[model samples]
Target: MTETFTYTDDLQIEVVNEGTAKFEDQKPQALIDLKSWISDEIKAGNIEGWLPYNNFESSVTWKIIPK
Candidate 1:
Protein backbone atom coordinates (compact mmCIF):
# COMPACT_ATOMS: atom_id res chain seq x y z
CA MET A 1 0.00 0.00 0.00
CA THR A 2 1.06 3.53 -0.63
CA GLU A 3 0.78 6.08 2.15
CA THR A 4 0.98 9.82 2.24
CA PHE A 5 2.12 11.50 5.42
CA THR A 6 1.31 15.11 6.15
CA TYR A 7 3.05 16.72 9.06
CA THR A 8 0.80 19.06 10.92
CA ASP A 9 1.14 20.41 14.46
CA ASP A 10 3.27 18.87 17.15
CA LEU A 11 2.56 15.15 17.55
CA GLN A 12 -0.05 15.42 14.85
CA ILE A 13 0.85 13.64 11.68
CA GLU A 14 -1.94 12.90 9.26
CA VAL A 15 -1.69 9.69 7.33
CA VAL A 16 -3.56 8.76 4.20
CA ASN A 17 -3.44 5.25 2.81
CA GLU A 18 -3.92 5.41 -0.89
CA GLY A 19 -4.90 1.81 -1.41
CA THR A 20 -7.72 1.85 1.13
CA ALA A 21 -8.58 5.54 1.10
CA LYS A 22 -8.20 5.52 4.84
CA PHE A 23 -7.09 8.43 6.95
CA GLU A 24 -5.70 8.36 10.47
CA ASP A 25 -3.28 9.93 12.91
CA GLN A 26 0.22 8.54 13.02
CA LYS A 27 1.38 7.08 16.29
CA PRO A 28 4.13 8.75 18.28
CA GLN A 29 6.58 6.09 17.19
CA ALA A 30 5.75 6.90 13.63
CA LEU A 31 7.63 10.14 14.14
CA ILE A 32 10.82 8.22 14.57
CA ASP A 33 9.99 6.02 11.63
CA LEU A 34 9.38 9.09 9.54
CA LYS A 35 12.66 10.64 10.52
CA SER A 36 14.52 7.51 9.67
CA TRP A 37 12.76 7.17 6.36
CA ILE A 38 13.54 10.76 5.46
CA SER A 39 17.14 10.28 6.45
CA ASP A 40 17.47 7.23 4.28
CA GLU A 41 15.85 8.94 1.36
CA ILE A 42 18.16 11.88 1.75
CA LYS A 43 21.18 9.61 1.78
CA ALA A 44 19.89 8.00 -1.38
CA GLY A 45 19.53 11.53 -2.81
CA ASN A 46 15.83 11.22 -3.42
CA ILE A 47 15.06 14.64 -1.98
CA GLU A 48 17.09 17.82 -1.59
CA GLY A 49 17.20 20.95 0.53
CA TRP A 50 14.54 19.86 3.00
CA LEU A 51 15.23 18.41 6.39
CA PRO A 52 12.84 17.21 9.07
CA TYR A 53 13.69 20.10 11.42
CA ASN A 54 13.50 22.80 8.81
CA ASN A 55 10.07 21.91 7.47
CA PHE A 56 8.15 21.19 10.62
CA GLU A 57 6.19 24.44 10.75
CA SER A 58 5.31 24.36 7.06
CA SER A 59 3.17 21.84 5.26
CA VAL A 60 5.19 18.91 3.98
CA THR A 61 3.76 15.98 2.09
CA TRP A 62 5.66 12.75 1.58
CA LYS A 63 4.29 10.00 -0.61
CA ILE A 64 5.44 6.46 -0.02
CA ILE A 65 5.23 4.92 -3.42
CA PRO A 66 4.93 1.20 -3.75
CA LYS A 67 7.73 -0.66 -5.42
Candidate 2:
Protein backbone atom coordinates (compact mmCIF):
# COMPACT_ATOMS: atom_id res chain seq x y z
CA MET A 1 0.00 0.00 0.00
CA THR A 2 0.94 3.63 -0.50
CA GLU A 3 0.38 6.40 1.98
CA THR A 4 0.04 10.15 1.52
CA PHE A 5 0.35 12.67 4.30
CA THR A 6 -1.09 16.17 4.02
CA TYR A 7 -0.88 19.02 6.45
CA THR A 8 -4.47 20.18 6.68
CA ASP A 9 -3.67 22.75 9.35
CA ASP A 10 -0.78 23.95 11.46
CA LEU A 11 -1.57 21.29 14.00
CA GLN A 12 -3.68 18.83 12.05
CA ILE A 13 -2.29 16.14 9.77
CA GLU A 14 -4.32 14.03 7.38
CA VAL A 15 -3.18 10.61 6.26
CA VAL A 16 -4.60 8.78 3.24
CA ASN A 17 -3.62 5.20 2.66
CA GLU A 18 -4.34 4.01 -0.85
CA GLY A 19 -5.09 0.64 -2.45
CA THR A 20 -6.51 -1.27 0.49
CA ALA A 21 -9.29 -1.30 3.04
CA LYS A 22 -8.20 -4.09 5.33
CA PHE A 23 -6.45 -2.90 8.45
CA GLU A 24 -4.57 -6.16 8.74
CA ASP A 25 -3.15 -5.73 5.26
CA GLN A 26 -2.17 -2.10 5.65
CA LYS A 27 1.51 -1.34 5.87
CA PRO A 28 2.35 -0.21 9.39
CA GLN A 29 5.86 0.72 8.39
CA ALA A 30 4.55 3.26 5.91
CA LEU A 31 2.85 5.23 8.64
CA ILE A 32 5.98 5.09 10.78
CA ASP A 33 8.06 6.28 7.83
CA LEU A 34 5.66 9.14 7.23
CA LYS A 35 5.86 10.22 10.84
CA SER A 36 9.65 10.10 10.73
CA TRP A 37 9.72 12.18 7.58
CA ILE A 38 7.39 14.78 9.06
CA SER A 39 9.45 14.95 12.22
CA ASP A 40 12.64 15.39 10.23
CA GLU A 41 11.08 18.15 8.18
CA ILE A 42 9.96 19.99 11.28
CA LYS A 43 13.39 19.65 12.90
CA ALA A 44 15.08 20.88 9.75
CA GLY A 45 13.07 24.09 9.94
CA ASN A 46 11.46 23.37 6.63
CA ILE A 47 8.12 24.40 8.07
CA GLU A 48 8.81 27.63 9.89
CA GLY A 49 6.88 28.30 13.08
CA TRP A 50 5.26 24.87 12.97
CA LEU A 51 7.03 23.14 15.79
CA PRO A 52 5.70 19.87 17.22
CA TYR A 53 6.03 21.29 20.73
CA ASN A 54 3.59 24.05 19.86
CA ASN A 55 0.90 21.60 18.79
CA PHE A 56 -0.43 19.84 21.86
CA GLU A 57 -2.20 16.57 21.13
CA SER A 58 -2.29 17.35 17.44
CA SER A 59 -4.92 15.53 15.43
CA VAL A 60 -4.04 12.88 12.91
CA THR A 61 -6.96 11.97 10.66
CA TRP A 62 -6.64 8.72 8.77
CA LYS A 63 -8.48 7.57 5.65
CA ILE A 64 -8.36 4.40 3.67
CA ILE A 65 -8.93 4.25 -0.06
CA PRO A 66 -10.65 1.19 -1.44
CA LYS A 67 -8.90 -0.77 -4.11
The clash numbers for all candidates, in the given order, read 0, 0
TM-scores vs. true structure, each candidate? 0.34, 0.37
lDDT of 1 by residue, 1-67 (tens): 3344443332222233232222235556655766566658656866423333323533234533332
Q: Which candidate is the best by TM-score?
A: 2
Q: What local lDDT does model 2 show for residue 46? A: 50
RMSD (Å) of each candidate, 1 decimal: 12.2, 12.5
Per-candidate local distance difference test = 0.43, 0.43
Colliding pairs, model 2: none
lDDT of 2 by residue, 1-67 (tens): 3334545433544343333342235479745655676666666765422322213333233432232
lDDT score for candidate 1 against the true structure: 0.43
Candidate 2 local lDDT, residue 51: 20
